[model samples]
Target: MRYPIETLGEALAEGIVTGHPAMPQFELTPPEINDLLSYLKSLE
Candidate 1:
């Protein structure tokens, strides 16, 4: 969460797929990303 919401949104929009074995590959819809960003920003 060190990154700004805009940067996080941009990254989320493209989807996230890590090579790490424990990480899950998935993409979030615009609304979902917005929800997540809201929750994250609440912590700030």
Candidate 2:
């Protein structure tokens, strides 16, 4: 899924590691990461 930011830091912190090589180029912020977690949680 795409995040608000453009970094993979947030996704990695959340244990959502992706095998895609381009993932490293993405940039994500703390708040945006939090939002991603919240959204992911709702999927449960």
Candidate 3:
């Protein structure tokens, strides 16, 4: 989409595979991101 699939995957994997480094923290695994992304795509 906006940043290319690989780019999006990387961003998702970061806070996911590792963990958010800053405040207001949250995390998502690869599978969770994929599911969220899939839901988002369905809205279009």
Candidate 4:
């Protein structure tokens, strides 16, 4: 990961919105975000 997991989590919590054609904006609950972060961390 290029950034710290916390930073990634924060971004996810805030909802990722971009002007790009392919990317979609989305947000998750704190627990859902934490679960996702844990899964990503497990890959390492």
Candidate 5:
């Protein structure tokens, strides 16, 4: 479970200003978070 803390941090920061309704509020399990991070990192 290795999420890119930075990505979550950035999302939180951006959501603060944009007030995005899609922004998630709950904490994700380690595996789910890691999977998302892996997907995003691969896009780079």
Candidate 6:
């Protein structure tokens, strides 16, 4: 099953705050996060 789009965005937001294994920690505005999530959802 696929994960919810909002969940993905939340995870991404958290990862950016906590830092992911291969990703550097960075801050993103809410709109930016929404844009990213939109793009990711397109791929799904």
Judge candidate 2 at residue 3 and give its lDDT: 57
* Candidate 2 weakest lDDT stretch, 10 residues: 3-12
The number of the candidate with the highest lDDT is 1
Q: Judge candidate 1 against the unseen true structure and give its global Cα lDDT, from 0 to 1.
A: 0.83
Ranking by TM-score: 1, 4, 6, 3, 2, 5
Q: What TM-score do all the candidates reach, one by one?
A: 0.74, 0.47, 0.53, 0.72, 0.44, 0.53
- For all candidates in order, the CA lDDT equals 0.83, 0.62, 0.66, 0.82, 0.58, 0.71
- Lowest lDDT sum, 10 consecutive residues, model 3, at 15-24
| lDDT score for residue 8 of model 4 | 88
lDDT by residue for model 2 over 1-44, one digit each (tens)?
67544454445566665778776655557777678767766776
lDDT of model number 4: 0.82
Pairs that collide, model 2: 6-26, 6-27, 7-26, 7-27, 7-28
lDDT of 1 at 23: 80
lDDT head-to-head 4 vs 5, winner: 4
Better of 1 and 5 by TM-score: 1
Q: Residue-pair clashes per candidate, as listed?
A: 0, 5, 0, 0, 0, 0
Q: lDDT per residue, candidate 5, 1-44, as tens digits?
A: 33355667455344434357685555556677667767777897
Native-vs-model 6 lDDT? 0.71
Pairs in steric clash, model 5: none
- Arranged by lDDT, best first: 1, 4, 6, 3, 2, 5
lDDT of 4 by residue, 1-44 (tens): 26588698888877666768797667799999999999999998
Segments in model 5 whose C-alpha atoms lie over 4 Å from true places: 1-24
